[model samples]
Target chain A: MKKILSLGLLCTTILLSQAQAASTPTVSGVFEKTVHAFAENHAPLGQIPASDLLNQPVAGIDEETGFLKVQTPKGLVLVARAAVTTTMTAAAPRETSCSYIGTLAASGTGSSSGFASNCKAGAR
Target chain B: MMVMFWIVYKFFDPLSLESATKNSSAQFFSAITAPFYGLSSPRSHQRVAVVTINDPTLQQFDAALPLSYQRQVFILRQILEADPAAVFVDFRMAYEHTDESLSLFQSVLDEAKSKHIPIFFARGEEGQDQIHLLPPLRNVESYSNALETSSAYPLLFEEGNAALKEDEPSQEETRKPEANAAFDVYRSLCTSTWSGQCGSFHEDDFRRPMMIQWGLHVDPAQTQVSSLANSPRNICAVPFSGGFFCRSIVQSFTLGFRAFWGSSRDYEVGHAYYPLTIGAHQLGERGLGTPAGSPPLSHLLKGRAVFYGTDIRDQHDDTVLPFLGRVPNVVLHAMAFDNLVTYGNHYFHEPSEVEFGHGVHIGQAEICEFILWLIFTGWMAFKFYYSHPEVPRGHGAKLRHDIRRKSRDFLSLSLSVNALVPAIFCAALAAFDLSHQPTLLNGMDEALLYVCLFLVLLGTLVLLRRSAQRSQPEEAEHAHGPEESEAEKAEKFRLGFWAHLALLTSLTAIVFALNELFIQWPNADWIGFILLWLAVGESCESTGFVLTFVNFLNRRSHALTSERVPNSESSSQ
Candidate 1:
C-alpha cells in the first residue's frame, strides 16, 4: 500500500512537470519553418508568436496599456496586444488550439504580417 | 635572529604573497634560461603552431555570430587533410546540443578517427558541477584509437596542507568522489591515447594534476630510450605497495600531444611553428574562385600540431603570467608544451633532495648551507661592530681627529655592506638558474634581515661604548682635582637613556614606513630597500647632531650656573 501510494505520487509529479513545460503554446507548419529560417539567418523575425517571444514566465500584463509582459533571456519585453490577432476555432475542445496572426511594427512604423499556429486556448 | 628569519621565510613566502605582489621565481628562471638555451628564438626549430581565430578569420565565417560547430568541423577537416603530426584542440566543448549540427560534428570526428589522425579535445569543469564532454561530442569518445580528451585546467603549485598516507588516498579524498571520477575519466582518456592502455598513468608521476614534462632532447647524441631511462622526474610509490612500484609521469595534455607527434627533435629550440591562418571569406573564396594558383591549406598544416582558439578582445581569455605579463591563455599552453617537448628531460624537474609537504622541505644540505650563511652573517655583524667603536666623550679635539681619520673607514664599511645587495641578487639568480635551488629566503628578505642585524649590532656597540665611558673616570677632571658626584652621574645616565630611547623610536618608525611602502608598492621594492638604507644613515647623522647640540647646551648651562653660584657665595661671604 505504501509503495503504491509513493508510485502514484511520483507519477503525478512527473505529469505536473510535463504540464508546466507544455504551458507555452507551440507552433508548427509554416510559422515553425519561418522561425527556424530566421534563426539560421541570424535575422530578427517580422513578427514572433507571444509564446515564442516570451518563452519564460510572465511577470505581468497591463490590460489598459495593451502590453503583455513576459520574460526573455535578455530581459523583460512589453509586447503590444494591439498587434496580435487571434482566430478562434469553432466548437474547439476546452483546451483549444487557436491560430494567432499579427503584424510587427518595423523601424519606420510599418507593420509586417506574422502567423502562428497551435496557440493555447484562453490566451490573449 | 636566525629563528625569527626562518619563521618569516616559512610563513611569508614571496611566491605565496597576494596575487598582485607575487613574483614567480620559477617562471622568471624558465624565461631567462629559455633564451640562453635558444628555446625561445624563432630559429630554434620548434614544431608547434598556433592557429588563432582572430577577427579577420571570424569575419570570413557566418559574420552574424561566432563560428558555429559546423564551421569548426570544416576547419578541422581542412587541418586533418594536411596530414599534421597531431592536432590538439584547446577549446572546450561544454554545451549541450540536440540539433542537426551535432550529427555533422560527430561525423567529422568519426572521419578523423577513421583516418587515424590523433585529435585531442579539451575538457572543461563547470565550477564544482558535473564534468563531461559536451553532450553531442561525447560520442567521439567511442573512437578510442585516434580520439582522446584532456582537462583544460591549469595546474597550480600551491602549498600542500594535508599529510600523505601510505595506503590511503591523499588529497583526492577531500574532493567530491564524482569530481575525482570525472578526473579519472580524463586521465584514462589521456593514458589510453598515449600508451594505448588505461591504468598506465600514475598519480606519483606529477607534482600536480596535468603537470607534464615535455620530452625534450637534452643531449643530441643520446638515444631516446637512454634519455628516458636516465631522466630524474619525480616519482611516487603506488598506494599500499610499500614503495614497490612507481611510474614515470608527464602531464595529460602534453602526453596526448607527445603520444601522437612523438618526441621533439634537437635544435627545435628557438624556432616556432607559425600556423597557416585562413579567413572565412578566404575559405569561401577558395570554393568560389580558382583554387589552382593558391597553395592548398593542408600543405601548410602538414607536419605540425595545429592549435585552434579565439583571440578576440571581448572574450577575455587572457592571463597575467611571469616574464610575459598578460598573454592569451593559448600562448601559455603553447609555451609550456614547447618547454616540455624541447627541454623536458633537460631543463625541468623537481630537485631530488626536496620533499613536497605543507611547504617545500629543504634537505640536510640546504639546512647546512643556511646554517653556514647564518654564521657568516653573525661574524660579519660582530666584526663591523667592534671595528667601528663609538667616539668617547671628553675628547672633543681627539674625537674630531678620530672622526677625520675613521671617516674613510666608515665610508668603506658602508660601501662593503651595500655591495652585498647586488652580490646576493646575482647569487640568487645563479642558484635559481643553475642549480634550480631557491635560497632559504629571497634576496630582498635576506638583505632586509642583514640590514636589521647590522643596525641592532651597531646600536648595541654604541650603547656598550657609552656605558663603558660613563663608568670610566674622567681624566680631565682627575687632572684638575675634582671628582664627579653620584647625583650628577645619575642625571647624566637618565639623559643618555632618554636620548637612546628617542633614537630607537625614530628608527623603528622609519623601518615600519619602509616595510609598509615595500608591501604596497612591489614594483618599487628595491628602491624602497635603498631608500631605507639612506633613511637609516640620515637618521643616525641627525641623531648624532642632536646629541652633540644637546651636550653643547648642557655644558654652556652648567658653566653659567657654576659661575653664578660662585659669585653668590663670594658676595654672601
Candidate 2:
C-alpha cells in the first residue's frame, strides 16, 4: 500500500510540472490591450497604488486549467476564465494578497477543486 | 585561426547556426532572383483571383465599416452564385448583438453547402471556441490568420496553450497545431482539382517553410479593354487614375531599360491579358441590374480559388514584396496558394541535412559549396603558376652559363609577377563571384589562400633550382646535384608533392568550414568577409613592396657600375 501510494505521488508530480511548463505563455510581440485579473475564487485582487500596470493585457489563456493569465507589475496573476463579461471590468482594491493566493494554488494546499462552479453560475 | 573561430562559434551558439545561415542565404538568393517572377505571373493568375472590399465597396453598399450580418449574407450569396472553385474569407466576424436572428446567414451557408463549395473563414485567438459558440458558422472551416516570414504557407500555427490540448481519436485526427489560412486553401484547391490523386499528404512535407516567390502585379495601363462602353471585362473597370502619368513614365523607362539589356516583353503582355482582380461591389452586384456591357462573372471566377479581403486605406494589413509593391494581405495568401498549385510537392525550400543529435550531421549544400570552391581555387592556382613559367637553358656547349643568366632573370620576373598578377586576378575573380551572389561557389578567402600557396610553392621551386645551378658549372639545374643521387632526388620529389597535397587539403577544408559558419551569422558575418578581402589586399601590397625594394637596389648598382667605367677610362687616358 505504501509503495503504490509513493508511485502515484511521483506520477502526479511529473504530470503537474509538465502541465505548468506547457501552460507558460510567451509574449511574441508588443501588446496594446488590457484585461483585469481575478483570483481562482473569482474575487478581485488588491491593486497597487499609482501602478502603471493597472491596465494589463491578457497575456494568454491557460487551456488546461481554464485560467486567464495576466502579467502584473509584481508577478503573474491567474484569473478564472469564466466570468468573461464581469472579469473585463476595471480592477478594484481588495483585501486578499495575490502572492499568497498564487502560493496556495502552486502548493495545492487550498480547496482548489472546481474553481469555475460559482463563476459560471453567476456569470450568465 | 580557423580552429579558434570554430570554438567561439560553438561556445556562443552550439546549435541554430546551420539553420540561421541557410535561412538568410535562401532569402538573399531569392532577393537576387526576384526580378524573374514576372515570367510566371500569368500562370499564377490562372490559379487565384482576389475580390477586395475597399472604400468604394462600402460606398456601394451604403454601409459603414464592418458590414452588418445581413449585408454579409447578401455578399456571400452573390459570390457563391458565380461558381468558384473555393472561397476564403479574410474577415473575422465576432459575435455581436446576441438577440439578432442568424437565419439569413444560415441560409447562405446552406446554399453554399448544397452547391458543394468550401468557404473558409479567418480564425482569430478564439479558434475552435468560436465554431462551437456560433451555430451558423459550424460547417465553415477555420484557418489561423498569422503572417509567416520563412514560408509562403505554414502548416501549423503556435496556438494558445498548444502542447496541453487533448487529442481526438478520429479517422482524420486534428492535431494541436492549427493550419494557416493559406495552407487550408491549398489543400482545398488540390482536392477540388485532382480529386482521387491528392490523397492524404504527410504533414511533415510542409514542416519546413519555403520562401514566398511573389508574382508581378498587373499594370492597369497595359490591361486589354473591351471596345464596348461600360464593360467590366477589363481590370481597368476599377478606376486607377490616381497616379496615371507617373506610372506611365516609370513603365516606359523600365521597358526601355529591358530593351537595352535585350530582354523580351512577352511576360508583360501575358500578365496584362490575365484577369486576377475583381472589385467586391462588381462581383456582388446582382442579375439584370448588372450593367449591360459587363462580361459574365462565371467566365472570370470559374475554376479559380477566390480570396475575399478588405483594401480600405489605413486598414494596416498591407505587405510590400518584390515585383509586386505594397498590396493587401489577402494578395499574399493568393500568391502563396498559387505557388503551391504551380509547384505541388516540388516547392523550392532550403536544403537541410539529417541531424542525429549531439552535433553530428552532414549537409549536402555545404559539401557542394566546398567542392565548387576547391575546383575554382585549383583552376586559379593553375592559371597564376603557368602564367609566369621558369625559363629554360639553351642546348649543348655553353648550357651551364646560359642557365645561370636565365635563372637570375627568372627570379626577378617571378617576384614581379607574384606581386601584381595575384592582386589583379583576385579582384577580377571577386567581381565575377559577386555577380552570382549568395551561391556556394563564391568564397573570397579560399581564392586568396590558393594564390598564396601557389606563390610560395613556385618561389621555393625557383630557389631550389637556383641553388642547384650555382653548385654545378658543367650540368644544367634540371639534372640532380653531385651530392644527391637519382633515387634520393626522386624520393624528395615524391615527399614534396605529398606534403603540398596534404597542406592544401587541410587548409581548404578549414577555410571552407569557417567561411560557411561566418556567413550564417547575421550582420557580423560581413566583417569576416571584409577582413578576408583586406588580408588578401595586404598580402599583395607586401609582395609589391619587396619587388620595389629589389628594383631600387638594382638601379643603384647600375649607377655605381657606370661611375666605375668612366673613372677607369679616364685613368687609361
Candidate 3:
C-alpha cells in the first residue's frame, strides 16, 4: 500500500512538473540541444538518460578541432572529434516534443528538481 | 548542513558522475593548453554564451550549412560532460568560429547530423496575408524583431586583413573601448534532431557562437554522423564540429591558506610554472620523453581511456584574434576554449559575487591578523599570571617562560611580560610567507584581530587613568579604607602593565604593515614555512596571570604563600 501511494505521488509530481514547464519563454535559444552537443562527446555511457544531457556536462571540445573528450575513473578518452552540428524548426507548428521546445516553449521534464525542470522552459 | 549538501551536490553527486568526469578531464586539457588563465571556476564547468536571432526568416539571407537534429544530439551529448550551465547559440539557423582550415568544422557537422540531429532549410515567416517576405521564419510575426535583436555574426562578416594593427593605449587608459577589434561573422545552419536535441546550434556560432557540452552517455560514436550542407565548405569534412564540448556545472575551487605565514614572493603568475629565475638564480627545463611506438587500441584502453585532440599549433597558417593579434588557430581554440571555461563562472552573477581566481595569490592582510591575535593572547595570559603569582598555576608555566626568554633578544620574560613587539615583528615576517590565496575565513579572522587591536588600545587608556588616580596622594592617603589602599597599589601595577602591552602592540602593527606592502618573498616553500613559524610562535602559552585565568577552568587552587586561605581569613576588611 505504501509503495503504491508513493508511486501515485511520484506520478502526480511528474505531471505537475510537466504542466509548469509548458509555459512560453522569452528569447528562447537552444539550451538542451546545446547540452546534447556538449554531452554527446563528454559523459560516459550506460547510466545517463537522453533527456538529462542538459543537466550534465561530460567533457570539453577543442575549439579548433571540435573534438569532444572526457575523463573516466581510468583516464581521459576522446569521445568525438570536432564536428559541425545543427538546430531545428517545426513543420506543422504544433506542440513540440522536447526538441522544438526552444522557440516552441512547452512543458519541462518532471524527473529531477525544480532547477532542472526550469532549465527546460527557456530551452530552444 | 547546507554547505555539506552543496559540496555533495556539486562534487560527489551520483547523478553527475560520468558527465562530471568528462568535464573535469576536458578542463585538464584546457589547463595544459593555457596555464596562464585564472578562472572563476574549474576547467569542467567552462561556459560558452551565444546570442543570436531565433527566427527562421532571418536565416534566408544566406546559405545555412545543412545540419540535422540527430547530429545535434550527437554533438550536444559530448559537451554536457564539462558541466556547462548554458550553451547559447545566438542565431536561429545560420552559424560557427574560425581559422583557414574550415574542413574541420565540415566533418564535425556531418558526423553529428548523420547520427541523429534534426534540421531543415530556412522556413519563410508567415504574414497575416499568408505571403512569405524578406525574413523566412515561422515563429515570430514580425521582421523588424529580427533586425533589432541581432547584428551580422563576426564569423560571417570578417575582413581578412593581412596586416596587424596596434594602437597602443596610454598608461592610464586600462579599460579602453578600442580593446575590441573588428572581426568577421560566419554563417551556417545546423540539421534537426529529436526533441531532446534541436535547440543547441545558434547562429552566433559563426563567430561568438555559444557552445554546449557534447558527451553522450549513450554511444553517439556508433551512431551515424551527418553534415550541414548549408555550410558550403565543411559539409562532411571535419568530424565533430571540431573538438568542442561543454559540461553542466563546474564546481568552484575556493582556495585558502593552510596556516599562518612566513615570508616569500614565490607564487608570481608566470614564475610558478617556470623556476626560470630566483633573484640571480636560474633553473633548467624538463623536456618531453623520447617518442615510443604506437600502441594498439585494445592495449591503450587497458588502464586508460585514450583521448585524442589536436594541441599542436596550426602547421598551415596562423589565425588572428581581434585584440591580441596573430597566433596559431589551434592555440586560439585552446586558449579561447580554456578562457571560456576559466572566465565562464565570472559571469551570470554580480561583480562583487564574482571570484577573481585568487587560488595562488597570498597577501599580507591574512597573516597580519592571525599572528597578532595569537601573540597578544599568549602574552596577556602570561601577564595575568605574573600580576598575581601567589594564585596557583601549572607546572608547564616555568617551561613556557624559559623558552620564551631564550627566544627573545632584549626583554626577559621574568621581569617584563611584554613580548608583543617582537612577536608582531616575527608574525609580520610570517605573513609575508604565504604564497597561496587565503580563504574568506582568514580574512574574517583578520577583521576580528582589527577589533581586538581597537579594544586593546582603549583598555590601555583606561588603565593609564587608573594609575594616575592611584599615584595621587589624596587617593593613597584615604585612612578609612584599607580596600581603597590595596586598590591603589593594584591600579599602579596595572598601569605599568598596560603600558608595556600597548608598546608591544604598536610595534607589531608596524611590522605587519611593512612586510605586507614592501617585502616580497624570494621563494615559495619558505613562505609556507614562515607562516607556520609565526602561527606556532603565537600559539605558545604566556606564563603569567592570563595563563592562570584559562587554566582555572580545568582546576582550582589559590594560595598566596604556601597555604590555602580559609573563608574566615578575609573578615578583617
Candidate 4:
C-alpha cells in the first residue's frame, strides 16, 4: 500500500512539473519575437505576443523614440526596445511510437515477424 | 618494486600527457568546485568588458576583410568617447588603405593617445603574414595575436619568437619583450584598479603564463527554460539550475570524491562565466555617448578594459577556453586580462622545475609525487611484512588464526574501517595542501578547505571510537589460538613472501600508470590520492587489521568450489 501511494505521488509530481513547464512561454531571437515587458522592479508589466507582429516577423523601429512598432489587440503599440528581451528556451524532443520503432529496427534484431506484428497493431 | 615504480613515473612521457592531463583536470576542478564560486555570488568580472563586432554589427557596417579603415576609425572613436581604461583591437588590418582612409584611422589613434586611453592593435603571426598596420596608423601600441593551445594564456612573448622578429623596430617597442594585448592592458590599468598589491614593474615578479581561474556567474533571469534555449552559452552547465541553492544542495552529494575527476567539453564551459559583453553596434548607438546623467555605456565602459573584436559566427579567429568553450580571440584576451587584474599575478602556474643544489632539476609536482609514492610503499612494506607476527600470538590472535584456517575469514568489518579511515584522512590532508596559501584562498579553495577539514574531523572521531572499542580485553588467552602447527606456520610464511610481493608490486604499478596517464587531468590528483589511500588500506588489511571483505570473497569462492564437486573421488580426479 505504501509503495502504491509513493508511486502515485511520483506520477502526480511529474505531471505537475510538466504542467508548470508548459505554462511558461519561450521566445527566441532579438527581433520580431514575442516579448513580455517587466516593470522597474522586474514585475510583469505586459506581453507583446508574436500575433501582434502579424504572426510572422517585423523589424519596424521608431527611429526617434527607439521603440519597436507592433500591432496589439486594441491598437498600434510601441514597446521600448531595451525593455524587451529574447528568452531562448530549449526545445524538448517529442518521442513517439514511430521513433521508438525506428530505434528498435536500428538495433539490427533482423526479426521481420515482430516488426510486421508491431506495424499491424498501428504501433508506428 | 618501489625503485622501478619511481623510475617509470619519472621518465614516463609516452604521450604529451602533462598538458592534456592538467587541462582536463583543471576543467573538472573548475566544474565540481563551481558552487563555491557562487559563495562570492557575483562572479561576472567587472574590470573587463567585451565590445564585440558581432554578426549584426558586421551586417550593419557591411564590413568584410580587409576591413575598411573608416569602420575601424568609427569603432575607436566610439570606444574612446565612453572613456575606456584600455582598448584591445583584435582585428588585423591586412590590406593597404588609401591615403585619406589611413589619415582618418590615424586621427583616431591620435585622439586615443591624447586622452591617455591606450589602444592596442592586433599584430599578426604565422599564417597571416601580410597583417601590418599602415605607418601613419601605427601611432599606438601593437600586441601579438598568437593563441596558445592551453586555457592558460602566456603574457610575455619574446620578440624573436613570432611575427615581431622580422618587423622593423617601431616607437611602441619597449625594453621589455612584446607582451600580449591582455597583459599590456592589465599593466596599464592594474595600478589604479588594484592599488599597491599589483606591485612594481620588475620583470622577475610576473609568472609568464597563468591559468585563468574561471568565475561562475549565475544571472537569475537566465534560469528560465526559454532563456536557456536561446542563450545556453552563459549558464553553468550543471544538472540543476536553481542557481546557488541548487549548487549547495548538489555539492553535499559529491563530497570530496568528485574533486579529482570531473565531467569533461561537456564540462568545458560548465563554470558558465563570460565577461560582460555589448555589441559594437550597441556601444556605437547615438544615445549611449550622451554625457547627460550617467549613460549605460559610460557606466559599462568607464575605467574598464574594453576588447573590441569581431565575433562573426563563422570567423576563424576563435580559441577554446577550458571553462568558456570556443570564444573569439578578443574574449580570450579579455578573460586573461581580467584574471590578471582580479588576482594580481596570483594565477595558476605550470608545475615549475625544482632545482636540487648540485644542478639537478626535476618537476616540482613530480618530486612531491615520488616522495609520496616512496612513503606509501614503505608503509605498505611495514604493514604487510613487519607488522604481522611470525607465530600469531596476540590479544586478537584468534582472529588471525581464523584468517589462516580459511582465507575467507580475512574479510572482517575492521579491515574496511581501517581502509576508509586512512583514505579519508589522507584526502583531507591533500585537499588542504593543494591550496597552500590559505590567505589568498578563492571561493573554490575555501570550499575544498572547508570540506576536507570537515572530513578530517569526522575521520578522527571514527578512529577514536574504533580505538576505544578495541581496547576491551575480551578473549585474552584464546587470542593466540592453538590452531596451526609449527610446520604449517613455516610453510605459510615461505609462500606469503612471494604472494605479498606480487600483490604490492602489481598495485603500485597500476597506481603509478594511472597517475602518469592523468597527472594534469582534473581530479587526477584526487583520484591518485584516493588510490594510494586504498593501497595503504589494503596493505593494512594484509597485516591482519580486520579483513572481513577479503575473507568473505575467499569463503564464498571456497563454498562454490566445494559445491561444484558432488563426490570427493570425482573432485580429486
Off by over 4 Å in 3: A1-124, B1-382, B385-573
Candidate 4 lDDT by residue in tens digits, B1-573: 543434543466336344445555544555444444323322235567777766545433434454556556766787888888788888766446553345656777788878887777776553345445666646445564545553446677655554454466774355456567788777665544434645665544454566555544432321211122212333333333446534542553342234344433333222332456565655523221233333433245776788887665546776654433555677678777766665455445445577788998876666677777678666444434322345245545565455444432222346555456545654654454444432332334444544544444444444434443432232244357675432232233332333434444344433433332233322333333333344344333333322333344345465664453222122112
Displacement of residue B541 (Cα, Å) in model 1 is: 9.9
TM-score of each: 0.39, 0.44, 0.21, 0.56
Evaluated with TM-score, which candidate comes out highest? 4
Model 4 regions more than 4 Å off: A1-124, B6-24, B35-44, B94-104, B125-151, B158-174, B191-201, B218-272, B286-299, B355-361, B388-452, B456-573
Candidate 4 CAPRI level: incorrect
Query: What would the per-residue lDDT of candidate 3 be over residues A19-95, giving only the tens digit for each residue?
Result: 75443111122212222223334454433222333222334445643444443343334333222121212222111
Q: What lDDT, from 0 to 1, does candidate 2 have?
A: 0.45
Instruction: Summarize candidate 3's per-residue lDDT along B326-373 as a digit string, tens digits.
Output: 222222222233322332312111111123487643234234434544
iRMS, candidate 3, in Å: value is 25.0
For all candidates in order, the CA lDDT equals 0.36, 0.45, 0.27, 0.48
lDDT of 3 at B56: 23
Give DockQ per model, in order. 0.01, 0.01, 0.01, 0.01
Q: DockQ for model 4? A: 0.01
TM-score of chain A of each: 0.33, 0.27, 0.23, 0.27
